[model samples]
Target: MNAPANQIPLQSATVGSDDEIDLFELIAVVWNGRRVLLGLMVTAVTLAAIYVGLTPKLYNASADIYPVNTIQLALISPGFSADAENRATGELSPELLFNTALMKLHSENMAEQFLSTTGAQVNPQGANPQTAKQFLDALSVSKEKSGTRAAINLHGTQPQETATQLKAYLNFVSQAVIVSVSRDLLAALDASIQYIDRSMEQARQQAENKRLDKAAVLAEAADIAAALSIQEPRIDHLAHTEVTPFNDKLYLLGTRALQAELAALQSRKQKDAFIPELRQLEAAKSALLMDAEKVRQHQTSIDAFTLPASILAPTQPAAPKTALILIAAVVIGLIAGLVTVFVRQGIRAYKIRTQSAYMAGYKKEILRREGHYAVL
Candidate 1:
């Protein structure tokens, strides 16, 4: 027959109670694997420590500023009929502060300008684009936030470089961006609008000239009417002294002619009204005057941002990042330990199951004492 029906495998863990683990056994397992565990731990920790040690010490540089409101509120209401938004509405908002940070990282114009302003010319030593990217990569930004404090960080390998970049960012961009558009600048802009005012005055004058011209033409029409009236009376006198007293037809005709002449003179004023050219000119003048005034009003001066923002120096220097390193190490170690225990315990469990099957006859020994038949 087979070597024994119950003959089973060994070389695995979990052979029932024999393989059940206690604290000492766990310690023993860990100790047994110590060489391997120690090797791995040492390798990992050493590599980590080495990497961290080799990394260059970073120094953070940063600056802060805010937009400010310079315009008086009274001037805002009548013009745009909207409340002028303040630049620095109370303290500097986190958003505007980040705006400054964005300029540092993303604003190509600002970045290029900063480089130029700082005299950072391309390296003449034949450094390629990759080298330049690498150098720039050395720069990093971090946001520091608290309940009532916030700051942006500019980190670099070199302390002076950090300071220089921070200073440049503060001077070139922050001050201008943070402050509300200055009143002086607004005034200058308004002065430019005065040119539009001058145009309006000229337009008004043109309208006045058109009015005067119309009046003068009407006055000439009045003179013609007066002359016609005077001639009509003379014509009536001629009718009254007709050559033949019996020539009633000529007298009647002269009377009608006098009436016709007076009527024609009175109608001259009405003709001036119907003159198409003069009517068009008057309409044009009125349109131009209305348009010119609108242009002047639109060209009026306005302030840009309402409230201004201002930032003082940082409340404190950048925090130490050593805590991050420590946390990282602990996390890495924990993962390693957990994985090691699972692998070792699983193997031990499998061996115990195999050995318990191999020791199947031990169950028969107990069953026989109870007078129970047991299969081999």
Candidate 2:
């Protein structure tokens, strides 16, 4: 049989009402189960607190590394000159050097070098893989906004250990850079020494050649003077006798004049003439050698490379952030508790609706059975 149109519409409306849930009803359900919600909130908070309290605390050690402009020193060094090959490499800007240092600071090679330098043996086999891993885990390198410096940070369970590790890492990086620069400087110094040797040798050779030329000129002048003296006797006797002639006297005077001119020319070409120029060249060579020595001193001295600031004790723990943990726990607890309350209320409502339906079906069946018996 077909249900009445009005009844069908009313039934449809009832089903729609069941599907629509009200905000007030949800609030009422939560309120009715306020005890359970509170219990769940308290339980969640307690668990979070326990976990936070039991977790190990980590220490953070931080330091600011200011890369010194050592490239300027290289540019100014007299012994170490940039050749065409070096110029082809381009200028070493502060930014590039900083990035290079930063990369080396975080490199595994540095970690291994550090381990060897510090004698920190971790395993029985003398392999420090674990320590290396720990060091890498703790290490962090980042650039600052000012662009002149970088920040180094490390984390460890102990404050002293963290600080010490950071200091060692910085020392390793600084020493590595200094060693590299020193090697280059030393190599340049050796080259400069060789160049100076060649230059001095050449100067000495030229001076010797000048001396030989002066000696040959003096020998030739001496020969010419000896011949003039031999003729002098003949010219003097003729002047003393009645054969004293005008051509003879003229020849004598002319010969004397030639000797005087020769003497003047010889005087001009004396050793003294080349002494000043040769001395100047020697002085220049000496100065070059001195500058090379100065470069060697600079390389030997550790003052060329400036190390970063020393590492200090960590001011705070890196992990187990108390305020953040507590805040997070509170938020999670509140949410979980509210969700639990709503879920419990929804389950109870479902069970009540199911029981009412069952009861209504049973009642309808009984009524239909009674109607059938009465009709019979």
* Off by more than 4 A, model 1: 1-15, 32-36, 69-105, 120-150, 175-204, 218-376
TM-score of 1: 0.46
Write down the lDDT that model 2 would get.
Answer: 0.63
Report residue 194 deviation for candidate 2 (angstroms): 2.0
lDDT of 1 by residue, 291-325 (tens): 33433443234222222233233333343455576
In model 1, what lDDT does residue 244 have?
33
> Could you tell me the TM-score of candidate 2?
0.66
Clashes of 2: 0
List pairs with backbone clashes in candidate 2: none
